[model samples]
Target: MHLVIVTAFDYPDGGPVAARHLALTAGLAQEGHRVSFVMLHQARPPAGARSNPAITWTSIARAGSTSPLAWRLTALRRLDRSIGSAAATGAVDAVLAAVRDPLLLEATLRAARRRGIPVLHELLEYPDVVRPPGPLGRVQEQVFVRRHLPAFDGVLVISGALEEYAARSGVARTALLGSIVDTALETPLDPLKLTTTFTVGYAGSLVQEKDGVLTLLRAAAAAAARLAPRYELRLEILGDTRPAAGLTATRESHRLGLDGRATFHGLVPHDQVRGILARCHLLALPRPVSRQASGGFPTKLGEYLATARPVLTTAVGEIPRHLRDGETCLMVAPNDEGALARALVGAASSYDAAREVGRRGRGLIDASFSAPVQARKVVGLVESLRGARP
Candidate 1:
């Protein structure tokens, strides 16, 4: 099947979103599906960006000197033209969009309707769940969720919570496509050797409310205190330090007396993350319990697991369903600094046992969450949608 994938992620080197799309599209291409990846917001490819010969990449640059509404309409017109051109050649089987804008979604539906093709939405998170919006944004999201979402021919959700939400929102066809990683790209770390410095690494947004970076910081401080004179604790954070609001991780680290021990590598390219993470003793995704946490799965978790590093994360969302507490990963309660600290200390103390658990977690990802595995589900969904199409 030939598929047109529309997304808002920056192409080639844009962080996790771009990585996720690239992995999925590469898998589709490997399955003999022609993929056209259309970037809705990126103007041009990044410097030193590499191309995939199997997939075609297109970018819809923002129009100059126009009102916000006019820009959206212009972008929609460009997208419509792209879709029509592909449909005219009988090359497009379906349109899979990972877009959040309601106007764009509406325009996509109208364009696909005209081209006699079905449109599928890749649902990652509810708009109002993870990031709370203003009043107008809230109203817009409500309209998008209740009205625009159900208009799609099918919806691909990333987590069980989102699948349920899609069903409740009246979506007829829904498929769960969780966080995907190309395990082939990952080289699991060899058995950990006893080291004086144990590093706990985290990648993703540093937002305290979203990723619980502050909690992780507090836990790291507590764990460091507990480790005392035996071992030195180091915290390595990757991603943006600026938060949407509240205390920044850097500031919190200083306040918690972890200024010397914590190192913040702000926003590196996705390709370099694995190499950096592999050097760490343990990886963490201490996401606190919230509506957003429940609704979405972290893409970084798959990447962390691929490194075969003991991942310490909370039992929230669909994670508990896939990973066993002591068997696969070290599970802890959300937002609990004490529990997180204890878990970190335990993992650091029992390095050999934790390495084995990390290996099992990696096995789980290889068996289930790998790019090829999830991409097959997408192919199946596209085929079913094509079959149902008149």
Candidate 2:
């Protein structure tokens, strides 16, 4: 089968969402499907794209102006044309779009209908959860929940929580196409050897509100002060550090006297992330309670599990449901600094046991969340949609 995946960002971009798509695409291709990616707004072949060799990328033209409105208009026009052309020329057999913009999604549906092909929407984030707090957000939510979703043949959600959201939003057919980790690429590392400084790793944005970067920093500082003699703790946050939150977080770290204890490796390629994770004694995913947190699962969580490292994350969304609190991964309440510090201290106190828990987390990934596993489910959904098309 030839498949086209539509996204709101560039193909194989440096982020967790792109990582999820690339992993799924690789799995689909490995399952003998030719896949292509169509990016709506941004289109610059990521410097180090890890997409499968069989996966092709199509870039749509964009407006010269940098304004958000202009970018969207140009993106919609180009997306409709590009998808329609591909469908008409037999370059694609089915459409799998992961777009949040209503207009871009409409364009994709129109293109699929033009060729009488099946189209499915992949819901990574519930729009209502991430939308800005304003009337415009309500309007967009109505458009997505009432207008766009039911029009599609089916929906592929990132979590069971998201599947419920889709069902309530009037989507007739929904599948839980959860996040996939490329365990083959990111095999579990051996138990980390004791070093002078215990490294706690985090990968992704420093978005203070959503990812709990601030919380992690404060917790680490508190933990370091308390456990000064036992083990020196350091944080290695890897991702794009250009956001304003990064600067603010850095200032806070210094204000908390964690100047040298916290290191930021800004925006490395996806492939190198695993090597960095391998150096860490523990992985931290201190996600706070937010709209995105409630409806979507983080791709980094899957990767963290794949690394076979003891993970410390908040009990938000499907996290606590999917992973055992004391068995697989350490669970802390969202934004609870004291709980996070205690979990951190506990992990350090029983380092050997935490390694056992890390292996257990990896076991869960192998059983249910590996790339091949989730990709087969996604391909099954796509095949069903294709078969249902008249």
Candidate 3:
């Protein structure tokens, strides 16, 4: 099988899209499929991208692709050039778009349909509701949802929670694709076992409302002050934030005197994540975002589990259901600083038993979230979509 995956984010960012795409495509190719990526931007693939040995990348646009008139025109040209001799004419067995950018999804699907091929819309994020209909919103929710949802040979639902959302929204052929973890990138490690110097890590984006960066920062500051001598606590926030959204959070972090205690290793590469996890006693992400806090499985939870690092996340959303608490990963209430601090201590205090907990957590992932498992399930899910056309 030949596959094409479309995404809006820049490549190699190692966020959810990159992680799942890398794992699933590589696993599929390993299982005898040729895979190519069509990124909205020229997101250069990660350095060591060899899951199937036949995997490749083609850039459609860059970050500024969504810019105003000048850049949008340039982006379309770039898109033409990127796909001109290759993608536009390239022969692929199946073209799959697994993202939220409806325009790209529709354009690619329309092009693929012209060739009489299967177009699988791997639903990553629920249809973008933030943006209203007008210009391209002309694609009514029914038209967009029904247009894209039912047309695909299959639909890849990221989580059961997301599947339920789509089902309610009328995506008939959706399947719970869950998520995939690159075990190669995030192999299970011995849980950080130390009687001292307990470090909590948040190794992803820095979006304030969604990812709960502010909550994590304040909790870390409070934990730093509270858990200091007892646990030798430090917060290693390993990602970048949206300064353009206004640097209010950064200013608050500085104001709260988290400058030295909490190290912000802005945007570490994909491979380095596991290495950082080895140093982290517990992976901490207290997301307050409605989506995150409500229940959807944030991809980081999978990565943390894959690395055999005990996790510390909020008790919101489907997270409690997907990730077993106290067994697979620990949980704290969303944005509860005191509760978060207590979980940090409890995780560290129980560090002896917690080590096995981390190993078992990762073993559970190995049993479930490995690349091959996820890809095979994704293929079946897509195949099911092919059969269950409403």
Candidate 4:
């Protein structure tokens, strides 16, 4: 199939957002599709971003935040020419506007409509779920629920709950694809490769929405105070650090006298995280209530399990369905300092028992989370659209 993927989220800086698309393009290309990734951001799309030779990329720099009047108009004009060029000969099979931002979703839908292309909007998170901000933000959110949704040929949701939620909003053709990860690269590391430390780790943006970062901080403090004097809990955080979010993540570390004990490895490239997972004993994050938590599959969760590390999470949303507490990991309530503390203490007291949990997690990843499995499922979706005629 010949395809064009439109995304509002900028790839290079959006971290996981960009990486996922790169993975998808590669996966689709390997499956024999001609793919083009079009970013809403204007910067030169990163060179060699996709491994699949059949995949290409395009970008439109939103001159003023991608939402402002001038920027939106300019983008639409550029998009008009681009889509017209792609479909001029009627050769394109479909268009996928992976809707991460609501405002741009409307534009893409309108453009895809003008071009007479089948469009699929991947709903990993919703406008109500993200709750962006201000009058314009609310307008965009409502637009997604009221207008943008109905414009697409089909809707792709990452969770069963999300599919039902979309259905309630009168969305038809909604399908739950769950979330995806390249699982082959995610297999557990050799036990001998890991250098054990009394450590608890969390990776990804230090943003407050996730909730897991804070939970990990409190748990560390509790573990430090409650554990044997010889067991010093070390902290390892990976991902981007924004000032607003960093203030909180760091404040707790200082108050707990964990300055020297904690290490913040900021935004290391995607592959570097896998290597860090090898030395990690436990992956901690309890994002119980975030929109992403409830509506999407976290890529890191699969990676952690692949590393065969025991996870201490709230197990809410897709996390619970994917990770079984006691069997594969330990679950605590979200944002509960006391519960998180207790879980930490328990794990510290019985490191060997915790190791068993890690083993189970790795087994789960091996059994169900392989990259081929994820790629094939996605390919199946695209294939289903192949024979439909206008």
Q: TM-score: which candidate is best?
A: 1
lDDT of each: 0.81, 0.81, 0.67, 0.69
- The alpha-carbon deviation from the true structure for residue 116 of candidate 4, after best TM-score superposition, in angstroms, is 3.0
Between candidates 1 and 3, which one is better according to TM-score? 1
* Candidate 2 off by > 4 Å: 42-44, 47-53, 62-74, 88-93, 132-135, 239-242
| Model 3 alpha-carbon drift over 4 Å, by segment | 43-52, 59-93, 99-101, 129-143, 241-246, 292-295, 385-390
lDDT of 2 by residue, 1-390 (tens): 788887776545547677887787777777777777777666565655544567777767463556778777877777777787666545576788777777787888887788777788878887776566799888988887788888888887888888987788788777786668777777898889765678899998888877999999999999998777879998888866777988888888889998888888988776677788888999999999988888878888988988889999999988887988889999989989999998888888888899999999999998888877887886677667766766
**Poorest lDDT segment (10 consecutive residues) of candidate 1:** 45-54
Error of 2 at 360 (Å): 2.0
For model 2 the local lDDT of residue 191 reads: 84
> lDDT tens string, model 4, 1-390?
777887666654466556566555655665666777665565566645655567666666554464556655566667766666667644676688865456566677778777667788777775576656888778877877787776667666767777877787776565565434555445566663223357777888687677567767766877777774757778888866657787777776788778888888877776577777666677887775866677777766766676777788786787787777788888887778789888887876777788889889877765665544555565565556655534
Decide which is better by TM-score, 1 or 4: 1
Each candidate's TM vs. the true structure? 0.93, 0.90, 0.83, 0.85
Worst ten-residue run, lDDT, model 3? Answer: 76-85
Cα displacement (angstroms), candidate 2, residue 185, comes to 2.0
* Sliding window of 10 residues with minimal summed lDDT for model 4: 188-197
| Candidate 3 backbone collisions, by pair | 11-43, 41-61, 42-61, 294-317, 295-317, 295-318
How do the residues 205-315 of candidate 1 rate in per-residue lDDT, one tens digit apiece? 877778888899999999999897888999889977555433467887889999789998887776677677867899999999987788888888888888888999999
